[model samples]
Target: MVTAIVLAAGNSLRMGTQNKLLLPFAGTTVIAAVVEQIVKAGLQELIVVTGNEPDLVHQALIHLPVKLVHNAGYGTGMTGSIQTGIQSAKGNGYMICLGDMVLITAQQYESLNTTFEKAYHRDKTCICLPRFNGVKGNPVIFSSAYKNAILQHDDPEGCKAIIQANNPHIVWVEMDDDAVLRDMDYPEDYAALINL
Candidate 1:
């Protein structure tokens, strides 16, 4: 079983005072859409790490069947929220999802989850990363074998360093769309995706 960890603790400073995750998308908020896809994928468990506007984030996702945890150290960096999620996650594999990447479809999540299970059977330390048109993308999956590595990760910028160090264990899953490459950080990104 793999647990989906949605990282939604960012301050969204790049969006100029707007909580990008709270923005409307596809008849629901951005974070909700992202979580809905994961839920639809039927993963074993789902944990959402909330920060910034915790109450609002909670309100937006309260209707969904997901475990929401607050990251008190979120202002420090993403690693802390990741640690929070990792602490609560109880699955053999953990899928690190970005809450603002609403474009990723349920089918894509299912595909990645399927690939992670198959690859895990072959190698316990297997990591599943999605790529589109040769470019790597978000929502990578790591087996619990790397739980300590991720928990001990000191970088505040995210898990790129860990991913690089374990390059040999990575299983690059080719994706059919660039949705994996698109994450809404700026207003223009939201504008473009919303218009699509």
Candidate 2:
């Protein structure tokens, strides 16, 4: 089974005082819309890691059947939340999702999972990543074999180091759109999302 881990613990430092995940998108909040697509994709389990404003995030996702985990160290960086979510995950594989990337469709999420499952069955240590054209994108999936590596990851930049070290294990899945590459980081980014 694959557990979807939605990382919603950003401080929105670039957005200046606003939490991008909580901002309005698609008639619902940003994080909720992102999670809703994953829920629709029918992943085995879903875990959302909250920080900044945990209560508000929870309320945004109150109707979804997802497990919410509070990452006390979220202020540090994304790696801490990644570790926190991995610690609570109960699956053979994990899909690390970003809450701010609201444009990723349910079909995209399923495509990643389908590729991960097929590759994981052949190699239990495989990692699945989405690529648009030749560019890599967010919401990567990793087999449980690398759980310890992810937990022990020291880079505040997140899991790039692990991906670099395990090049041979990566299964690059091509995506149909650039949605995986876009995330709401600033006011302009939000504007672009709304305009689309």
Model 1: clashing residue pairs? none
Give one clash count per candidate, in the order shown: 0, 0
What are the per-residue Cα lDDT tens digits for candidate 2 across 1-196? 8999999998999998988898888899999999999999999799999989999999999999999999998988999999999999999898999999999999999999999999988999999999999999988999999999999999876999899899999999999899999988889999999998
CA lDDT of each prediction against the hidden true structure: 0.94, 0.94
For candidate 2, the per-residue lDDT at 27 reads 92
CA error at residue 118 for candidate 2, angstroms: 0.7
- Across 81-188, the per-residue lDDT of candidate 1 in tens digits comes to 988999999999999999999889999999999999999999999999999999999899999998998899899878899889889999999999999999988889
